[model samples]
Target chain A: MKDLDGLDLPTFEDVIAAHARIAPHIRRTPVLVSEALNALTGAELFFKCENFQEAGAFKVRGACNAVFGLDDEQAKLGVATHSSGNHALSLSYAAGRRGIPCTVVMPRTAPQAKKDAVIGYGGRIVECEPSTSSREATFARVQEETGAEFVHPYNDPRVIAGQGTCSRELAEQVEGLDAVIAPIGGGGMISGCCLTLSTIAPHIKIYAAEPEQADDAYRSFKAGHIIADDAPDTIADGLKVPLKDRTWHFVSNHVTDILTCSEQEIIDAMKLTFKRLRVVMEPSCAPPLAAILKNPEVFRGKRVGVIITGGNVDLDRLPWIKG
Target chain B: MKDLDGLDLPTFEDVIAAHARIAPHIRRTPVLVSEALNALTGAELFFKCENFQEAGAFKVRGACNAVFGLDDEQAKLGVATHSSGNHALSLSYAAGRRGIPCTVVMPRTAPQAKKDAVIGYGGRIVECEPSTSSREATFARVQEETGAEFVHPYNDPRVIAGQGTCSRELAEQVEGLDAVIAPIGGGGMISGCCLTLSTIAPHIKIYAAEPEQADDAYRSFKAGHIIADDAPDTIADGLKVPLKDRTWHFVSNHVTDILTCSEQEIIDAMKLTFKRLRVVMEPSCAPPLAAILKNPEVFRGKRVGVIITGGNVDLDRLPWIKG
Candidate 1:
């Protein structure tokens, strides 16, 4: 399925194939419910705990699909990506499982914990300046040297198809969900949800949540086209990226709405989830919950599914705690 | 069953009955596994996440059993306990569900987060000095004034029976576990494991893990009798209480060994678990994993079920971070 821009869009078939290809590698993460959260939101919320997923994020699903789907010759060439977050670790985890070489182009200023995680998964890190031009230049040189395939953090079709498997599992695990909301960064996760739900259950509304500090997706939704941002800042570090053409296709065509919440709201929601759901998740996973809490009128009396995107937090610098 | 110490010990049959009684009130928490942790320790570790329980701890199982088992006349009196930990909030959670009043006599210096949780769950708190004598004295006055039944934190057979249900579920969830380990704070959770595993899966050995700073349980195990500690201190606050007679009966008979770890080891294990397992657990839950890492010979090449006792820590004061 190719879009008007000639870029291929993933279909329901691709999602199904992704599920089968990655089933052996990825965990069918559990969906948990908290009565306390339900009471607070005035809506029953089912949390898809991808924080418990292999490599501690839903990104592993796509990473595994991409790595394992490679031809024998392509496998020998290895895989590469530019990410200073969960994707870097997740791709490393997937590549290691397949016994292939993995290279990550990470910003020199990325947290030591994240760098350690990628290396712990048998990944080699190449330092890059903390800028898009520097990252792309470094990544291109590394790819030329190693002949490694580039897997965009969220812009690739294989990754979107892989992410779609999460919603499929959620639909099977739960019945009669009225709406599903997920935090949108490059829109890989939310786009995946949009792809799967639009095909199998169009009645189920799909909503995207974003941090107010990085509201490019929300503005793009309002304007009905792609809107790219430059160096947006948010405590949700993973959500600072702008959506590319592939993800924007799903966001513009299928998503019902895009909601945004403030930095303080994101931190509060993250802490409430820690306190009530008793789960450890990152700030990127909080915006959907924050939006749900902030706009109760839209969610009241409905059964909502909230995707907890990842749990790669730096415990020493927890947002709510002072140094 | 009555022991020579003139105290009644809970049987496996009691565990079965307690399971049926509290099934509706508690969560059948998921058992999680981390390949990274397994590789690190050279053991197949299955973590039963009781931190995700209804009141954020396994204590809720016993609290529900005790609160719901009261006769009509006793029900009118409600329930009371003396503690500044999960027990206070758990009993309150169960009592609130049953529409009964719950009172807790807690040390004035207990963390504000814990006190807030108890009050949030509809449990009334009475402040006392941070000493056993003061706690007992305050508890007696509250019991006298309210006529509420005194539910000993871990000494009661009913409470022990409720705790046993956790292992029964573990035994059903995972097959052929060579051993089981849990932190022994007054031996409530360990006693419960002993009661259930000793009957249904006698081939499996039960081990108790304790912090060296509060090693009364470990010392008592070696001394061949109960050795009450006088105000021992540790980062693992939940394990500071000395084992009472009822818990000692189960620990002395069914436990294979008692393992102890340093305070630093507990902190390290807690942080490691938070990073690897992506779960928020209290310091109390880390001792078992710490002991497993410290004494790898006992657990290596064995299937081990580790009980993550609870996840009720104050996020603002995480042990690893400097204030």
Candidate 2:
């Protein structure tokens, strides 16, 4: 609940430190420049293809940093977290690499691909009903039973620092970006991107693209208060989280704007990404592209960076019309 | 039908030259190493991801090389070819870049995605019934009508020279690969690979994988005579071609073996590739993985190179499961 001001805010140095610490454990996923996309949007776009990252998402950076940054005793106790999909897979992969035990509390509705990925990486899963209350109760039970350290998916400072490593690499890879747009789920990735951009390239603007159906963060950003949605319905299951107090502070201070895209637009962009870029991206990952495609005038002729957050779409339930 | 023995084969120098010619026009797709795959298959696997190559296939290498290799007068006439899918898209993309006219004779059964890609890149499509006889007849009519130069998808020397550039880049990327395995359709890619390896590293064994249902190339290699299957049925639609005379000669002289995998094994391998590698591969592209999984003892402890040739899978009619 502490405000992310003088004492709580992460400096550029902290993000740089996080980058160095997680460098060995995480991959520097390639930044692909799409001529097709740029020509369509009229914006010179650079896609930071984090979908190609280990565990098929950017969560590995933060998860690896959080688990490895722990003290020896804390590391011995191992780490526990709750996630819909990407975070669990990343935490499981990172923890597995360090030979530490990991337990992930996931919604039973989470995609089978993600659950398989988490299990494949040797993580124990505790499934709960698809509700926030159920998730919290299950997490509490698991934490008490194992006496493990909880690495909050987005709210914790360590996770934020780890996530910031993505933007650090982006800033190092491409210079003079006018802005960076990242899809927001629990605010972990965007918070990290903001922190890194603020330190490394303070002039570069950072934006968050939220699904219209799950626009809690966008509403909260405009209202200057934390917003919680009772039951959001959107294809981007990843971006269904309500804003947390810690994430609200970071999001309010660091992010330039929180934009919303329609579910249909997200689906169209997802299809374009798969067909043209030949990369599998879930609906949440398409928000940045959606924003650029819908509001080309706002981003035209500017050097825009977009993060393809993940590629864990279920083949059977693909949102786009196939063949 | 001219004997390839008297006709000079492309040397590694020729491949290297072709690479320089196409380098500016093509992408150097990533070479991904999978520790998990290596552990599962007992082989050090280096996957040259040509699925991520320009136009979503390695066919672009040959298409670009042939297009650019043409004399000014010949190029003025433009080019024409017949393909099931990937080759049409590649040729369209290459021709579009060169500002030249291109005519593609595609089977009516080809996936809509492939047709869209070809059209999107400004190629004129001439649909033919799904058979070798119909395709050849349609292509001949188009060639005669347009007075366009013919670029045979597999049989042309220029096209083979272009495809060789993939192995040239692969050899440079991964050092000391003991062998290279690629799926054999018309034997264009394998012929090119063989031509490159024979001149650069003659000791590096080359293997061709063919689906058991469409094992004409495999039988041809064993019998010391070019074999043709009048009717072949397999999940690997890309490997349905009967070997061409030129390619058969190269396979007989240079390739160490032509391995066969079951349709079920190919589907399983395709699913594994998507799950573990986060890459969408068609059944033909998964043949090397099937070979490694089915015959682990053959590749155990050896540095094996697998060319993921293309990723033009039809999501609607996925070879593995009906959606």
Q: Top lDDT: which candidate number?
A: 1
- Report model 1's TM-score to 2 decimal places: 0.97
Q: In candidate 1, how many Å is residue A318 off?
A: 0.7
> How would you encode candidate 2's per-residue C-alpha lDDT over A1-323 as one tens digit per residue?
12334436555576777888888887888777656777798988888888778888898888998888888888887899998678898999989988888999998987787788899898999999988799999999999998889987787778888888898888889988999999997898898887778777888988899889999999999999988998899999889887776667678888989888999999988878776666677788998899888888789999988998887777666776542
lDDT of 2 at A118: 90
How many clashes in each candidate?
0, 0
| Residue A235 shift from truth in candidate 2, angstroms | 1.8
Q: What's the lDDT for all of these models?
A: 0.93, 0.84
**Please, what are the lDDT tens digits per residue for candidate 1 over residues B200-266?**
9999999999999999999999999999988888999899999988898889999999999999999
lDDT of 1 by residue, A264-319 (tens): 99999999998888888999999999999999999999999999999888888789
Output the worst ten-in-a-row residue range by lDDT, candidate 1 chain B: B1-10
- Docking class for candidate 2: acceptable
